[model samples]
Target: MTASSIEIRRLTAADAAVYRDIRLEALRLSPEAFGSAFETESVQPVGWFAQRLDGGAAILGAFRGGELVGIVGLMVADGPKRQHKGTLVGMYVRQAARRVGAGRRLVDAALDLAAQSVELVQLIVVDGNDPALRLYQSAGFVEYGLERHALKIDGRYYDDILMAKDLVGRA
Candidate 1:
């Protein structure tokens, strides 16, 4: 399918099944890109995924022809001190959907939601992931730091590039 044919929308509890499928696929295909392990999430019940939909987070999915093909998650911080902060996570686009603008649409949706309430949106991308870094950069996210050993999988460590974008202004 073409990029413009894909539709992006917020996910609800009813979407647990499809969400789980794409999520597991992401974790399996790119283990270094996320903090969650496929082995841990692969066994979770659909109810567990459903429950996640009710939190202080927004999960956006890209669908083409009614089939979910991509997803990105945004989480707003709780507590008075952290209320203006939001975090981006779980960004993934299916191999077939790459270079089709699904990732950009997903990020734009997340940013739109975040702009309503948060002052800043932050995300961690694995080092050397040029495509994702480029996406975030094009979306106005600037790298502010890097965390060494941000994730350890199968006895190997992967560093994470910390990037953030100010919603009120591009600072």
Candidate 2:
């Protein structure tokens, strides 16, 4: 994404095509990073995305020249204990979009949106993604704990650190 031309906006049902493209790209290139696979989601019905947006999930897309370059998903739960918390997931920025502030903007959008109904936001990062870890930290996320060998990718186990950020001014 270009420095001055990138736009960060809420993703709508009409942006499902762009969403699918970015999602598939993530799963294909970084299959170990996420819980789902391209083979599984690549064939899913389009209604899946439409229903997702129609529901309560919040999505943000970073677009440059009308092309989606990054995306983040925020899901707010309804339970008493979890109502004040939002979980961050499905965060990805295109390879071409790296180093251009696109990732930070996408994350900032998610964090800002989470502040509406959630007093805190939570996410997990594969320990090896140094840049992402730094970005999350810069955005006020702190490591709380690590899940030992949480993911088994390609016959190897990788640990992930749980991170949380408290939203200030929330009662």
Candidate 3:
């Protein structure tokens, strides 16, 4: 599918079921890429997922041919000292949607929302995920640090690369 065919929108509680399905798929297929585990999130009720959409964090979804195919989230800090910062989290694009612009559009939408309330946006990608790393970098995110053993699954450890983009002068 072409990039022009992908539709990006902020998800609501009404879209929780599709969101949950896509989220579980991501965790199951790419276990090392996320901090959350499929086994942990799989048992949660749909209401639990709905609550996440209803929560303050901005969760954006990508639609292709009227189906939810990808999702990304942005969460701004609520504390007094950290309120200027936000974290980009739970980025995933279905295998079928790979190589299209859905992932990039989702990131763009999340960053656009983050720019509204936070001066900087941060994200962590698994060390070996070159596509995701390149996507973030191409979008103006710069590496700040690396966290060793950021995720441990099935007796294996994975490192994470920390990246951030300053929104101070972004239009």
Candidate 4:
């Protein structure tokens, strides 16, 4: 799968299982990039995923012939001062779909949604995810900061780099 063979759409309750599956895969593949681990999320019940289906956040999914292949999440920052921002998380594309534009499409939808409800969009990427970092940069996201030793996985400390893009106005 490539973007040419895929279609992007907002996720609904019916997609909860697929969402869970993809997210679990992401955590398993890159334990450093995500805050949650497979050991932790595997314990969550289906209702937990179900309850997240429709909420303040916008969940985007990429599908190829009705099979979901990519997903990205958008959630509002909670607080008065930072309420104008949206946090992008749980972003992942299947291995076969990596080189294609599926990931870009997923993020584009998330950014568009963020632009509507928030003025800025932010995300945290693991320091070594160069391909993803480049993609985000190409999409107008800029590295803002880094949380040193932000994540610990497999007994190694890793830094999480924060990146953001201003959507309401310009970059």
Candidate 5:
């Protein structure tokens, strides 16, 4: 599929069912990539997922031929001292959707939304995910630090790479 065929937009509460499905898929398929586990989220009610979209966080989804194929979220910090910052989280593209520009579109849409309210956007990617590393880097995110053993799943330790992008001058 071409990049032009993918449509990116903010998710709403009504889209919760598909969001929950894809979210569980992401957590299940790449457990080490996220801090949340499939076992924990799989049991949550659909209302919980709907609240996630209705909450302050801005979650964007990529639709290919009207099917939700990818998602990314931008959460602006609410604290007094950190309101100028936002976090890019829950980024995932389905196996069938990878390499077709869904990932990049999701990131771009999230960053665009973030740039509106925050000067900086940060994210943590599990180390060794080269495609993710490249995607974030291509979007101007720079690595600031490494969190060793950031995720310990199934007795296996996985490091995380912390990245951030400054949105000082972007339009």
Candidate 6:
């Protein structure tokens, strides 16, 4: 499906079930791309995911024909010194929905939400994910650092590339 047929919107507590399904799918399909483990999140209560949409973080989803097909999250800092920053997280587009602009729309939606209260938005992409790397670059995120052994999955280590985007003009 193409992007034009999908609607981008912020998720709510009512969407917890669908969100949980997609999130777990992402962690299971791409273990190296996220910090959260499917083993841990999959067992969490549905209310846990609902609370995530209630206030703690802003999660955006891409819907096609009323079905949630993609998602991305933005968490704003709460500390005194870090309140002006936000972290981009949990980005995933189902295999069937990829390459039709769902990923880009999700990132753009996250950035749009972050721009409301943050000066900068940051994210960590697992090294060697060229498609994700290119998507971030196209959305104006620039790599700032690299962390070796950022994640260890199945006894294998993977690096992470830290990236950030200044929201000067967008804000």
What lDDT does the true structure give each of the candidates? 0.93, 0.86, 0.94, 0.87, 0.95, 0.93
| Alpha carbon deviation, residue 48, candidate 4 (Å) | 1.5
Model 3: ten consecutive residues of lowest lDDT: 108-117
Tell me which residue pairs clash in candidate 3: none
Model 5 lDDT per residue over 136-158, tens place: 99999999999999999989999
How do the residues 1-171 of candidate 2 rate in per-residue lDDT, one tens digit apiece? 356788999888888877888889998987767878788999977778777766788888999888999988999988897798899988898998998899898888888788877888999888898988999999889999999898887789888889999996743
What is candidate 3's lDDT per residue for 66-89, written digit by digit as tens? 999999999999899999999999
Candidate 2 shows a clash count of 0
Error of 2 at 6 (Å): 1.3
Tell me the TM-score of each prediction against the true structure.
0.96, 0.93, 0.98, 0.93, 0.98, 0.96
How do all the candidates rank in terms of lDDT, highest first?
A: 5, 3, 6, 1, 4, 2
TM-score for candidate 1, residues paired by index: 0.96
Name the best candidate (by lDDT): 5
For residue 12, what is the lDDT in candidate 2?
87
Q: How much lDDT does candidate 2 score?
A: 0.86
**Model 6 RMSD, rounded to 1 decimal:** 1.1
Q: Which tens-of-lDDT digit does each residue in 1-171 have in candidate 1?
A: 677898999999999999999999999999999999999999999999999876668899999899999999999898999999999999999998889898998999899989888999999999989999999999999999999999998899999999999998743
lDDT of 4 by residue, 1-171 (tens): 556788989898888888889888888887887898999988887767777878767788999888888888899988899899899988988887888899998888888778777998999999999999999999999999999999887789999899999887754
TM-score of 4: 0.93
